[model samples]
Target: MSAHRLPGSGPLMVFGGPYSNLEATRALRALATAKGIAPENCICTGDLVAYCARPNDTLAQIREWGCTAIMGNCEESLVAQAIDCGCGFEAGSACDALSIDWYRFASARVTAEEREWVAQLPRQLGFQWNGLDIHVTHGAPSKTNRFLFASSKASSKREELDSTPAHVMLAGHCGIPFGETFDRENGDQGYWLNSGAIGMPANDGTADGWYLLLEPLAERVRASWHRLHYDAHSEQRSMIAEGLDNGYARALTSGLWPSMDVLPAAEREQRGIALQPPALMIEPNH
Candidate 1:
């Protein structure tokens, strides 16, 4: 329920799931700096540390950039000193088992101050661009660990949208980039966008990650998803060197997940298929 409002003039760059991939994190920061986007205008949807090898280094990079970040399930678990990641993966499933390895590695690597900083991060945030209210969260408004996929039913998305006061929801944690708008018969319109993960591939049979940019254009905001190309082979090498044997290490090069246990039926069926997220123009319904 804690909401921080971000003021947007130029494009607001949003990404998620650094996942301890130092290479991707560094690439994203370099891209933002080269484009002259202020650090404050760059928002991260959390999971700053997760499956990759350089958890502490990744956290350092994000902090140095000073990007506005929300707490993801991974951050929540790490901050709370919980037993497992809050991703809601089924017990004894592939995701759960794999998380055990990375979670332990990340938990042991982060500094005490880093843990405190993550513990204090807000669960949700709000901002405005081109007169449209935008909400940023790690998952659905109702649950930090909720999985709101692009393939979810329209009614489900509508329900999540109605639960929040913002006109648009910019979210992450599902690791897939999508922009969907829900319009009601009463003329109310809502937006749900997941810029996808910067630290990890979109399971699209490509090594490139994804990010989103929202640019104001007079009367509307243009929300565009862009692919991020980084040195995945280097990251994977680091992971192997660090003794991390999770499937995600190879996923960096293969652009596929080690397990489909976390994905819904629709998503599971589309595994290894490349994604081409389209640009969306959002205008105020009021």
Candidate 2:
């Protein structure tokens, strides 16, 4: 139930939260092509369709590229024919409101084939490489809608990790990229890697999106986060042209989310400051 053997056995690229920006999605695929990571080796953590202007285009891009994707809360909502996005946003919150617009847009545009494809996507993906077992999920093991942040309880994450029995976990849905290493000596050592969301900015006051590159090593897996440069001006233009919603449209260019609806206090405090994550930074002890 948990193990998959990737045919190529090459480095895999992981990303999340495409949010319907065709341009951003295209840029990501371009990066993969440049790196020679094929569609089978490139995995998306989910929400492939959401807040941007080109939901259909984004879906088409992913489909055309043939990357493997895990169903996010958005896909779950759409697949089950839920009225609103199952993002777990509170009613009347900014996220909830904005979500209504994008969700409706995405729901209306996704074709039958896309919906069927989304419905068929696996909830959890497991594969082995370099003597390590890697598990991929959109959120935590508990629910696809759950938001696991960098500041989320280590105890909570450890408890979730306990469920999978994996040496490393790749998670999405929090929209922030971070790599956390748990000590695990006293049941405290493991790695939680978030590829972040490529569709939207990280609220670091920059337009660059985030993705993770995992390279297998002799002793451990070396995972690093990279900032993706795309044309936010064009992404914003598309949003406005589509007449979806101005709040998210501006967020595209500003690189700061219009609403702090989902961000926790720790993340909210660091808003607007550019985040340049360290490079090739993780030397795992797994």
Candidate 3:
């Protein structure tokens, strides 16, 4: 894991999956600006390009702003000129089909300079945040495209956590906000934090996307999820006009993904329920 040495300063904003939604990307940046956080303190877990219509503009925004981005599977594929989005979706599934469309759309849009930037993104970013070693990656350590949700297996979560030297593993890829504090009898503990995606909703029945903030508390790291309200309607319209897939176009405003091809039954069950992820304070029992 590479290191992105960020100062343990003011409220730190971390987000994922720009997914080519320029509107969402712009709105998220505004939110951080209004919150008084600088670009250097903000980090993106990465998928800088994806389903939406404005992949180029979105990448250009973050590139000019100079935020640290971990390499997402989408970025990796785009840089390598791969065939698919590399999410490891099932063959011939709706997810895979839509991915082919968007991947081609994005691949054609990104310029050489943007591809260079994607090549420069870190696979995993590690840093000491308020006495905790925090590592950020698009997905799990075993695979860049692996999906780990709130309902992921306990053993698998523990295994990934144990393999890492960081006390906190901040992930994206799943496009949903979830936090799990794993406690071990040996007195070691870690947190699996997914900041969620600002480019698209968590399929939880709201037009707003999600992001997470790490507010250091005494002896704990406060994980807070916030809704990012962007111009989804306009973005969706643009996607439609651009001849992109209608599934993500509808997803932009409906907060409902067109396919569950990538999700497990647990996540599929939560569709349209509207998430209200509460702020959690993490503390390891000594």
Candidate 4:
């Protein structure tokens, strides 16, 4: 649970779930590099490999670039040699079945050294920015695979925030970008942010994935969600070529999950609708 401190005054780029899409990974890194966002300032919420082709290549890109990343549930499962993806899908569910195909493919492809590297990854990361204590995780602080969607109740987010001393909690694994602020006694406030995934679409009927940028202004910190555009056709073609022709492969183009099994009812209702993540401006305590 040790934290990785990011030093510098530049905007911090946050993203997650590379999910083994090498094309998207490369594009994202290229954009980050072009923006002069140093590798240290870019944080990945993990799942470097998942339901896509080219697991080895995708992980290689991440390692070569040397960004700050925490261990996601996929890494935990792979490192433990678990039989499944550790996504917490129920038994006999379509997600579970679909996971079996890709998990086996990824597990077989990743090297022993890579598994060791994944095992060594910290489960969470922390740093201080603009007078706020920021913590990052692949999922909720309490659980690696816990799904905290935008529609999750306010009380749930409050309890999650109360579990830690973080002023802001940034996480992934839910595959959607959102920002929420909770009220506390004496006018104190806490924040939860999901940067979404760069490797897959937000089920928003678009081929674009998402990332987040945190820019510290003079009076407040600005958190903005951005859509990452890459060649979804190329990614889909690769998956099809590799026989990964499953839900995730098609999800790249359709922007719809093959199954609603993992999503809450509210999120299920949002399938195929375009996502417009709101920008949040947070003021420092006076």
Number of backbone collisions per candidate = 0, 4, 0, 0
lDDT of 4 at 185: 46
Q: Per-residue error at 42 for model 3, in Å?
A: 1.1
Question: Candidate 2 residues 76-126, lDDT tens each?
Answer: 988998898899999999888888988888888888888887888888887
Residue pairs in candidate 1 whose N, alpha carbon or C atoms collide under 3 angstroms: none
Clashing pairs in 3: none
**lDDT (10s digit) by residue, model 3, range 49-97:** 9989998888888877676778899989988999889989989899988
**How high is each candidate's TM-score?**
0.96, 0.93, 0.95, 0.96
- lDDT by candidate, in order shown: 0.88, 0.82, 0.84, 0.88
Question: How many pairs of residues in model 4 come into backbone collision?
Answer: 0
Q: Which candidate would rank higher by lDDT, 1 or 3?
A: 1
Candidate 1 per-residue lDDT, tens place, 1-286, comes to 1124364588889999999999999999999999988788889998988999998889888888888899999999998899888889989998989999899888998899999888878888876667887788898888988888988887777777777778888899999999998885456888888999999899989999999999888888899999999999999999999998568988999999998887889888889899988899998758
Q: List runs of model 1 lying over 4 Å from the truth.
A: 1-5
> Residue 191, candidate 2: how far off, in angstroms?
0.7
Candidate 4 at residue 246, lDDT?
86
Candidate 2 structure, TM-score to reference: 0.93
lDDT of each residue in 1-286, candidate 4, tens digit only: 1225464678889998999999999999999999999888888998989989999999888888878899899999999999999999999999899999999999999999989877888898777778777888888888999999989997777777777767788899999889999885446888899999999899888989999999988878999999999998999999999999888999999988888898888888888899888899876644
Sort by lDDT, top down from the best: 4, 1, 3, 2
Of the two candidates 2 and 4, the one with more favorable TM-score, higher being better, is: 4
